[model samples]
Target: MTFIAGWLPSDLNNPSNDNIAGPDSVAIKGPTGGFLVPAGATVSNIGFHSKNAVPAKFSIYAIDFTLLAETGGATTGGAGDELFPLLTDWTPQVDTYVYVAALTSSYLTGIGGDANLRFMPYASRVYEDGFPNPFVQAGTANTPKQALWLDGTLAASGPSIPEADDITDESQPVTFTLSGNENAPTGITINGEVGSNLIFVSENTGAGTETYSYEPPLIADDDTTDLVVSVDGATAATVIAYTNSYDRDQLTHPATEAEYSENSLSYPNAYATTQPYEWKVVTDANASVVTINWNALEADDGFHKDVASYATPVANGSTTVTLGVFVPETGQAYQFDRTITVSDGSVVVTGEGLWCELFRDPTEELFTELFR
Candidate 1:
């Protein structure tokens, strides 16, 4: 086990001073040279201490490896074997203490051995010294500073959280788009746990707004979530709504009935009318049902009254009547009389049936009967 504790100095200590000890220097002690750490070892209190006024603040830095040094080496031969380096006219300071404890398992792992070993202590400013020095050098009276040899695994770095303005008003919906400095996530998810629920509508897919319409909207540190919207392994847009709102009118409409006919007078088709009449109408939603309304009715025609009086003929049981005017199939049917009476310079028919049939080229007898 290895424990490294040190105080961060305000700046580099004065050179040529072996008795001077400041806060910025760090002391690292662990398995080095022949003194290998035991297999089952635990290291704690390994953190950075700042020499700030009032109260010193320390933060624990979780690292996988520790530093060690080798001493008493020559510039050409033993100098290269030492773990630490020696600076020009620099002296090592005291008051820096680091602890190391090896677990029983460490011995089983091959790090610990029964042979006696000797290890040297080293100090270096992490920021200036660049850790994990490849060369194992020795320290001198003038240049006693050595490289910090830290060994262990480092924590994996994770993606950063997005930052934006915080919405305080519950009624206001927060809308945002997902973006990445380089690559966007494969997919994004949004949990709508907010007041009265919120809706997100997408015009691209008619997948109207997803609603988070609960009593209290779900609070999230960040609105954007990574999600993949691509299909068939193709690229797609990353634009999505975190919170949305839409009008109710855009989703619903009133039911309506339209004009229609069964025989030759079927809907969307107009057949010749034998008598004076108005158009009939039918209406429906998603389907066409009988939709009779005042809007569907056509204006009344004077010729219709005359045709209405002609009862179903006793002989053929049907009478063919011609309409004096064009009548749409959307209103009441009318008829002109079989017995017509001339009045005011025009032959005025007594009556006509509403929505009645019209006569083709009329015969002499039919004309006489209609004119009479």
Candidate 2:
């Protein structure tokens, strides 16, 4: 989801063409829209596509006109979907600039290859699904958006979340911390697919540390991060690909006003605070029937009595029985059953309903709330 071009690249792609390739033409102009491999990342799957009947000069070069790589001779007719993977050991340091250029046919002698032979970033490597031979319809193919791949596993760590796990939850806010190998990512997208509008920059606090804070309301959404640095205006190298998942929807409200305030980054009201009630169950190992004790001096609005039930099958060996709660009125307050009781059926193995507020602690309203 980080736009690794796993599914689609960020290059100029318009998959529609009425004209076909013949002898030769200078179609693609990489020198204008150039790209560079960043300092700490390894980029791959860089190739080009073609539909030609003759050979061509498809090559990448450094800014100094140094030839870095070149694909083999051209095929018969440049059929659509004919991908050519370049033979490249392309590894650039902090700032290595490169461009792709090509020449097709003899009449176009001295003229570079057709720049319009859209392709993956590299040379002829074809991957087609449910399509005719040569992938393209001989004459119909879109302006190719180069295929892109980045292996961040090897790249040194960049600014990262200190807590590393921030699932969407109403009760708990998320604090993202980045330290070590830190750099300001050019851009970030968070659940942008689902229209969850929450974007902010991390504060760069000298000493290789930066931080970003999201109030619970904002943090309680999707859980994915796509960070990237610009390669060219049209392409980029992924900086950090991260995802944090926790019991964002788990029930068991905060214990105190301070706790609620800390998790939500705001003051606590009656609904946000934990309820003064108990729904507990105990069972022995491998118990068939589990009994739950329910006593509510005052039922909190955030808890739904009907939906709170034993949400697991017969107790297995040291199994956990969950107390599931559903508050449909205010889904923001809806919580999955985080409270679990270890049960065999005869006695409760663990307490079924106790939530620990595990979020960044908040200080006073004047400082913390305003910051969020």
What's the TM-score of every candidate structure?
0.18, 0.25
The number of residue pairs in model 2 that clash at the backbone is 50
Query: What RMSD value applies to candidate 1?
Result: 25.0
The digit string of per-residue lDDT tens for model 2 on 1-372 reads: 111111112222432221111112112222323343344344433333333355554555554446766666665344433344456544443434454445443321131233333223231222233111222212223323333222221234343333333444433444444444333333333333221223345655443445544433322233344432221232222222332222223245544444432212112222333333222222222344333323321133233322123233355333333332322223323222322333443332332123334224323332343333
Candidate 1 lDDT tens digits, 100-173: 22111111111124212112112321112223221232334433332222222221122222222234332465
C-alpha RMSD of each candidate structure in angstroms: 25.0, 17.4
For candidate 1, the per-residue lDDT at 166 reads: 35
Q: Show how many residue pairs clash in every candidate, following the order shown.
A: 97, 50
For candidate 1, give the lDDT of residue 47.
Answer: 26
Best-performing candidate as measured by TM-score:
2
